[model samples]
Target: MENFVLILLAIVIGYIINRLNIFSKDAPTILNQFAIYISLPAMILLQIPKLSFSIDMIIPIIVAWIVMFISAILILVLSKFFSFSKEITGSLMLVSILTNSSFLGIPIINAYMGESAMPYVLVYDQLGTFIALATYGTFIASYYSNKNKITFKIMTLKVLTFPPFLSLIVALFLIGVEFNPVITKVLSSFASTIVPVALVAVGLQLQLRLPREEIKPFSVALIVKLIIAPLIAFIICKIFAWDNQASIVSIMEAGMAPMITAGAIASMAGLAPRLSTAIVGYGIIISFITTGFLFKIIS
Candidate 1:
């Protein structure tokens, strides 16, 4: 509850700062760079080393990918049906296919399902969403934004060179090793900055009023992300008879809003920048109600 409140407060503060024009136009870019290059890597180094992979953990990961894959296909079909341009289609793919499974998922799930569900949340984020962000996300950004033909080698190189992905690789090898107390504390401090820094960055870019052309894409993104995606997860859980805590957490994660970083990537790639920000901003606000409704249905 406290963490959820903090997210809202940080967003409000960022919105206020933007409205006052207290920061330069490049402020959000600087914050996002700090998050991607510094805080996100620190977080991976800090958390990934603590994870112990097991067969039991595969459920959430599998479900997360399934949801993303199905949703991505749906987005493609919808894009064709609506005759969306390449930029709008790319923006929808970034925001809707990826989910805010960590920053929002961890805290929100903790508040709803209690601390016992943390492991599943972490699994869904790191093994599923995080890896997808580094790999599939890089692919989306490169493939959609560029007019030139992108090759598999270029995609692999980008994933390998991504800061957080490199950190994740290093962190995996250090799983059994212990870190120095002082170093751990330093990493922890940096890791903690991702949430507020990211939310504030999102708020800084947020615009409530949408241009007329963006309404349909924005609406489609939110519906796919917050409602349709999770509903798919829930139905799969029933199909598999996964009536467990892990399944519950996975369902909630599937219901989360657009990934803030995904939106950042879309905007950075010049893929319908304003529309991307609007979906990410409003998606978070609306997901609160939608997630609550989902919890009642699934739980």
Candidate 2:
């Protein structure tokens, strides 16, 4: 609970900084790039090598893919009723499919379930959500942009060149090798900045004053993300009879708010920037309440 409170406090601090105009508008972008390229990759390199391989490790990835495809299909069917613009639809796909599984999910699991849950959290983020973001996410962003043509080569290159993904590859190779304690400590020190930096960056970028027109689509997207997605994960766990602790963590991670990077992806792709930002900002606020309720129920 202290950990979760710290996460929220970091966000609040960032928000206050933004409100006070303490930094330029570009501060969030710079912070995001730093987290993605430096802190996040270091964190992955430190954690992934320590993880023992297991078939169970793949379940979280499978759950993520299931949610992504299911959300896509649902969005396609509901598009008719909503009469959403191409940009709004694209933003919806990004938010609903991807999750804040790493930044928010890790802390929540660590607080509630302890170090035992770390390996599963790492798998869900690195193998599952990360891959989905690099591949399917890129495809959706490009497809919706309509301005830039997406090629198979481009998509493959995006995945291969992503810093964290590259770090994951390196970590896998070093899995069984022992590292000097000093080196490991150094890496861990750099890695430790990820969560707070990420949350602060999210807060800096967040805009709570949403446009009236976007509320309906945003609400539906959150429903798929925070509600329906986890319900599906719970059902999957029951059917597969996964380990109880892993299943609970998986469900809770699935229930996380929209991905922080989703808005950046949408904006870069020339999709609905306003809608994407609105979803991310509002989603994070609401998730505080929803995830707390979920933790209570599952506990």
Model 1 scores a TM of 0.85
**Per-prediction TM-score, please?**
0.85, 0.94
Lowest lDDT sum, 10 consecutive residues, model 2, at 48-57
* Number of clashing pairs per prediction, in order: 0, 0
Model 1 Cα lDDT, one tens digit per residue, 1-299 = 78779778878888898999999999888987898789878877876676576655688998999999999999999999999999999999999999998767866787788756765776688778987887788788878999546577866786778787688778878876789999999998997788788778767877776788789999999999999999999998899988888899999999999998898899888899999988988888898799889999888
How well is each residue in 1-299 modelled by candidate 2, as lDDT tens digits?
68888888889988999999998999988888888898878877777777676766678777777767787788776765889888888888898779999778877777788867776777788778888888888889878887777788987898899888888889888876778999889888878888788788877877887889888898888999889888888788778888566677788888999998877898788778888888888999998888888878776
Highest TM-score model number: 2
- Candidate 1, clashing residue pairs? none
Model 1 off-target regions past 4 Å?
A: 113-119, 141-148, 176-180, 268-270
Which residue segments of model 2 deviate by more than 4 Å? Answer: none
